[model samples]
Target chain A: MPQIFRRGRFWIQLGVVVALMAFGGLLINNITVNLIRTGLGLDFGWLWRPAGFALAETALPYAPTDSYAWALVIGWMNSLKVILVGLLLATMLGVAAGAARSSRNRLLRSLSGGYVALIRQVPLLLQLLFWYFVAFLGLPDTPVGGLIHFSNQGIRLLGLNLSVEFCSVLTGLVVFTGASIAEIVRGGINAVSLGQWEAFRSLGLLEGVGLRRIVLPQALPAILPALTSQFLNLAKNSTLAIAVGYADLYAVSDTTITQTGRAIEGFLLLLLSFLLLNLLISGGMALMNGAVLGRLQRSR
Target chain B: MNRWLDRWLTLMLLALLGWAGWSCLHWLWRGADWTVVVTNLPLYAVGSYPEAERWRPLLCIVAVVVLIVITLLGTRHGEWRRSLPLLWSAMAPLGIWLLAGGLGLSPVGTQSWGGFSLTLLLTAGSGLLALPLGIVLALGRRSDLPVLRGGSTAYIELMRAIPLIAVLFFGQLLIPLFLPPGVEINRVLRAVVAFALFAAAYIAEDVRGGLQAIPPTQREAAAVLGLSPRQSLQLVVLPQALRVALPSLTNQAVGLLQNTSLMAILGLVELLGISRSLLANPAFIGRYLEVYIWLAAVYWLACTAMALLARHLEIQLDPVRSAR
Candidate 1:
């Protein structure tokens, strides 16, 4: 009888959970029905129309006359471009800043402290906007006009630089993402035990060698997870290019939604692009984490 | 050899700092015009805001400060030594002020505080709203009630799987449709709802981690105390569970602050939006480095303050549990 009561209670609890979930599903269903009624019933036909606008920066071959699908694909490429460039830039900046923060030199330590604090407190959007507006906008005109064009193609600065839009976007992404990376790097380095640092230093191993071998090896576990999220952050943040009118994936999708009034389709594409990119980021990072974990275990 | 290298590096860094400081001073002070930047930034902050509406933000700021003071009272120690939490609490507002118009002296309107400020508002609001929702969601997810668990699991996993911007875009599209026709919601509010829902899902995960951390012994002891399941969990389990999860929770809050900058895409006029607007000015061409430097300083300060405060709170809550 006691066994029966115990089994029955278990089933009863399970039943309640099932019922609640069903209610949640019902709510979602109602939301979907409401969406369909508002002239937004699902269809992919809008994607076939021409995008009529040209991107200032894209990695793929594209024209204003390209299909919305192709334009979106190009925009996705542009987002990837920023994410890739941003990742490299942030990683480099973070590593350097992290090392700088770890320095025994008090001046370098204070400088890094100020740098990290300044970057982390303000929003990245402000930083990007500031970069684009105040810094880019404040450029002095060279001789004849506003933008200097080079070799009959692409915007130039001081007649020497090429690809100003890409450069500007790249610069914004690097600095914005770099600040977070610096913190991550600092944390990872700090995670290395004090004993490990002393042991390495006592052996006449230089600061760089101690950091590279004894500290960083131990620090990787701490750093990897932070870096993973930062990578995810970098990917999501790429969408901010829309504000600067930089024509990244999200920006192009916004333009498409405005032009075609296909908000549903436009958003779907934007979502899927980000979803896939993030999957790649998360998946890659997880794999990297697994590798690191295996190595950590082996070392143990 | 090491000492020589150190000396050379110091001299090089000093030289770099000297050049940077000198050039920045020249540019702001003499090169083009400080008058233009000084005027433009203020115009964005307080320009279109009605004088009375101005009190709203000030009130909000006071409320935030009050909350911080109250939360600080919840702690038993100085916030500065706690590192991450202190970094976040102090710096987030300071950064916001710098981005939002520096204590309202150089006031920028809500419309002008684009980029980071917009992101911060949206993210901060969402995070606050999500906390309760996350508790409910987590309770549902772990409920003895089968349907509730299923619902929470579906909601959480789906949200976790979807990128946040998609959630933002969907909210943008669907919010107006749900509203009575001609009664429009602001873009920022819509963004907040999206962010809240997304944050709830993540918070659920965080809550779940806390939930799992509670030992079976604690629950058994609660039952021995003759408490109901809810009472037992709330009083005994949760305190310990949440204490364990404090660091991750603080980390999430920090990330949310940084992520709030994403609102620049929606044209919601936060800090980033202000910077971009200023950057596009015909007069301030090629000042990307200058704006970025200023804005970066503001962000770092805000993030640092928050991190420090949270770290302080975590320590106060449980000295034995300190991880850092």
Candidate 2:
């Protein structure tokens, strides 16, 4: 009987299950009592009420009279806007810097290396504040009569009309994410064996052609997983928009909670939306990975 | 053909660099305000904490640095290695006691803590707390027990899906609400809890990667030697797994350190928070640029130091690299 008790799966399972249940029960009991004492119950009815605040930036139409739910949607839209634009810019910057690091020109290599080292070493929050509060805001405001414009033409230069908050958040995300992506890109390039380059040289191909035709194809498979993580990171980092007074989902949620005292509902929307967004990104990337790998295999 | 293309690219890049240099020079000459940063240097360093209590944070820093040095020395000698965990664990409470101050020492409230020291404290505190919890979660995820496995997996996935900012918000807003009435957890403690819990998820995933890398034979060998599963895990499994996980672990530490800056939003006057406070000061109204530059430089220096230490550790840990 003792041996059976020691070795049996039944007892272990029962013990684990019971312990889990008891923990859950204790948590629920605490929350219930706490909620009762606060003169409030756990309900999301506050979300249906007016938000009564305007978003600083929104891709979708938003007004002060919108429901808190609509406010969250607008916040979500703004978050998505930053993520999409930031991802594009970060990828471009990453590729350029990553490629430049391996350039024949000593100046290009050192410049890119310095950028990666400096940018990656600082916290993203500080960089965001710098870009927004200092870099953008400190710019002498569009000199009364428009900074620069061609006569009767639509062209303009250094007008600086974009919101400082938005510019800061976007620049911060790009600079930070781009540094990481550059490292991944550099690693991916290095992982492509030197033999490929030699093969291109034997075929009398130019350096640019060799890199584009021979190196990048091989590097893509290696780069994709890391690149996907960076994309996810940028998406999440967009939440830093709150710090700069940008009305991203997190910022809006903070306002909602402050206004309505429904922390649970406010955070639940944030958690669910982010989870869905990440699932979509990962799922899309997985499909792309499969397609790329399948093509590589067929070519082989 | 290649030369022509290279020449055109280089020329364009040079022109771009020149324009950037000119703009920077112009800004430095006309825009920057130096006096604001100079006058508020003390405020940036320690917020508005009492001048008499200044030695507390300094003591915390000295104790932590000494503990780290001793730990490093112990590991290098391999003689005091077994006691290292005990010593390391003690350092956290010790550091806290020194900073928070209770017996004979003047008590400095959590609200009083701010600036670079607070940032470092949060990073170190959360990191130390999270490592062991992360290892357990990683093990639980890999365990045969369905409940433990399911629970850990759920936790890690849920945490990974959300941003750190949201988790912190919940820490500030929800955690207090869930606690029993009349029980007060200070804001700094709440932020620390949030950071540890948040970091545990990522650390678990990183550790899980290490655990997965271990071959079945090592565990089987431990079993054949009459070792219990717990013994096998504590002795044979964890050492090898952690060795493999060290680089990723260091990366997570650096990331967590950086994430501690988010504490500013929770109203902790850490590095970024202190900077914001400086910017908001009426006297320093337009000196945001100069202050931010200083803040970024400090972070850059600290982060670079940590990154370099990580590189050194990576080299030391790798048998092939260390031999050279």
Candidate 3:
């Protein structure tokens, strides 16, 4: 009787785990079916159907009656545009400001301090609104005597022109995220050790040279993890584009949900896509960090 | 002349600030006076809120104030005491004040409250609700029972893996489908719950870290005194675990508050939503910069204060190791 009870209790624990997972799956399935009939929808078939709506700004030229796939494709491209630009701009600003924060220059230090304090404090949504309403949407539309006509979707700053939606989203994300990156950069730089600084000074190396050569090389590991984490944040922050009417992955996903009532599938795709994107980011950063570390190891 | 130059620069800055102020004033109500600005805020916000329910939000505010004072004083003694009851005094009034209508202010139900105030309330509400939820989730995740541990790991992770937006979407458009008919949940409340769950998962992980740090000897010591596992956890383990967890938890709370702006996407009239709405307005079509800057500045002020408070807590939390 005692053995039977113990065996039963063991099964109960396993049963409980199985039950929880089942409930979770049930909840997911129920919602998906309620949103869109189960087993009725298939991928790319919907892609073939006409989107029948003109997207405000698309990287690809698409008409109202374009394939739903094409619309999603266009949205995907538009999102990539922001992601690529946001990545570049944030890295540049973050690295530069972060480096400056560690600089001996008092003015530079204060400027970095002020930038971080102001940017890190506010929510990204507010920043996006500021960009959309105040910056992008509010820009003087004159376009230098009609040299080019730019609206909410695209822009013509001078003889050269490009995507305004991309620019706006990038600007918001970069400014917001760069503040975080700056701190990471500063921390990495500091982790290089004061002894290294003293040694470099004794060797008659200038501050700039020492930083570029000795400091940055040692600081790579310290910065990479934080930097990767911030990238995760950027990927998430990119979703705020729904406010400004920019069609990044989330925006596209949202539109698809509203149109097709496929909330689970749409968000599932978003989750997978972002997971892939973040993985790519971490993978690439990891490689770069390894290469840097390898070189350091070899140098020793 | 340096003095004069300083004066001129100050004047110039003030002029620029004044212009920003004017543009916001103009955008809010193109040349409208103070009375107009004040009146317009309600027209823009809490329009659907019942005037008879004005006392709710105010009462909430009063309750929050009293709760905070007591909790702050309560914490002067130890870091991990059963301050949960003490915390309610803080939360109840804030919740009541936010729902206020009978207190001579318009009682804007959650749906009616839009814009920045809505955003702040949603964040605060989620943080308030999530604390205990997070503690339970955290403790459960660390349970000796395999069932509890596995279930918890799944819930914490599933919620964490999905972007916050997905959670919000599920809460808003999807949850009602599974419920029995006529038992609809409010979307904003859903958002608060969702946000709370999301934040709690992260907090639980943080708390678990604190839980792990404590020596097994401490728990064993408590057991020797004939304490139950639960008692040992509550009386002996939790107090020390929480002392270390407070700063991180507070930091997380501040982060959740900022993240509440995402609720704007779900059509809540939080700060960001109001800013978005103003953008579509013809008069304020191009005045987004001034408005958003002002709004960002306000958020910055609040977050900066929280960051300082967190830093102070971190310093204070360092174990008071007395040297003889």
Best by TM-score: 2
lDDT (Cα, 0-100) at B187 in candidate 3: 77
lDDT of 1 at B110: 47
Expressed as tens digits, the lDDT of each residue in A230-260 for candidate 2 is: 9998998889888879888889888988888
Q: Taking the tens digit of each residue's C-alpha lDDT, what string does model 2 give over B168-271?
A: 88998878777767788999888989999999999999999898898988888888899887778788888889889988898898888888888887778988
Interface RMSD of each: 6.0, 4.9, 7.6
DockQ of each: 0.32, 0.49, 0.40
Classify candidate 2 by CAPRI docking class.
Answer: medium
Candidate 2, which segments miss by more than 4 Å at Cα? A1-9, A140-162, B7-33, B62-90, B319-324
Candidate closest to the true structure, highest lDDT: 2
The better candidate by DockQ, 1 or 2, is 2
The regions of model 3 sitting more than 4 angstroms off are A1-12, A18-22, A25-45, A141-160, B1-48, B62-90, B93-109, B115-117, B133-158, B212-232, B235-238, B278-286, B311-318, B321-324
Clashing pairs in 2: none
lDDT of 1 by residue, B179-232 (tens): 545466667668778888988888888888888877788888777889776677
Candidate 2 versus the native: TM-score? 0.90
Arrange candidates by TM-score, highest first: which order? Answer: 2, 3, 1
